[model samples]
Target: MRQQIDGAVVLTAADEDVMEYLPNRGVFMAQLLGRDRGNAFGFYRGTMGPGCEISRELHTETTETIYILAGQALGIVGDREVPLGPGQMMHVETNVHHGLRNTGAGPLEFLVIGHPDF
Candidate 1:
């Protein structure tokens, strides 16, 4: 069943479900909002342990934007590698292969928003 937000919905961390995207890598994600919730886009929060990296991948029809919330990471967009930290943001265009790697000593947390419900 799709969840419908009648008005303003406040999602607390304690109410969210955390999933492991990669086993034994300390990579976890929590889906905060999505089309199933009546949103036109998808919103997620991800955390990566030090030295962990997301395998390179791309969205064929959706564009993704990520905002670093804590710690540091290296964002690989196409052929460039950009260092990002808290308060920094990165955009990955549709069909562009991209990935992120935690480069800090601590956990790397970030918010991911994708258009068209990725």
Candidate 2:
């Protein structure tokens, strides 16, 4: 039997699933593309309010990339902290530790893509 496939051609941010990632940090994430939809990767948009941050973490099997859309933040890739702002991109190798903290006055918005899904 042939396998059935269900997916959308366009994913609207407004219709995506949003999750509050941290407590009292004003960090929110919206899954724009998901693995359950038969995708080879996971894509999400994260919004971090000023002073918000994601603690250091590593992905054992997935490589991740973050593209800054608006505002600025400090990105931790591996053991170093790098400044990131609008139009900047950061790549995290597999099993590397990474995180981000919003340091700008406005909300930080960015797109995150992970290989092999999350």
Candidate 3:
């Protein structure tokens, strides 16, 4: 048996399958769009109120890229913490310990894309 998938069949932000992950006080609205047994890809919209943040974690095989949409946040890339604002992008490699924190007056909003959908 053989199955075929058209990657351009049209996948939307809403149709990507949204899920909420509230880890260490931060909020994540994840939209999963692609998958292939061992690999997957998705986008995550994160929200963080005052003093909110995500716990540092490492990826086994997945990598991530994030785009700041609104507000400001502190992005921990490896050992250095980078300040992020609107239009800023962050790329986290696999096995790297990274996290995000809201350090602004308002809520933080950003888009995160990752592999394996994890």
- Segments of candidate 1 deviating more than 4 angstroms: 1-5
lDDT of 1 by residue, 34-68 (tens): 88763778898888899998878889999999899
Question: Which residues of candidate 2, in runs, are more than 4 Å off?
Answer: 1-8
Candidate 2 weakest ten by summed lDDT: 1-10
Q: Please provide TM-scores, in order, for all candidate models, with all chains considered together.
A: 0.89, 0.87, 0.77
lDDT of 2: 0.85
Greater TM-score among 1 and 3 belongs to: 1
Q: Residue by residue across 1-118, what tens digits does model 3's lDDT show?
A: 2233664444444444445565565565745444653256765666667788887889889898888999998999889999999999999989999988899988888888887677
Query: What does candidate 2's lDDT look like per residue over 1-118, in tens digits?
Result: 2233453455567667789986536889987666876377788899989998988889998999999999999999878999999999999989888999999999999999988788
Output the number of the TM-score-best candidate. 1
Per-candidate total of colliding backbone pairs: 0, 0, 1
Tell me the alpha-carbon RMSD of every candidate: 2.9, 4.5, 4.8
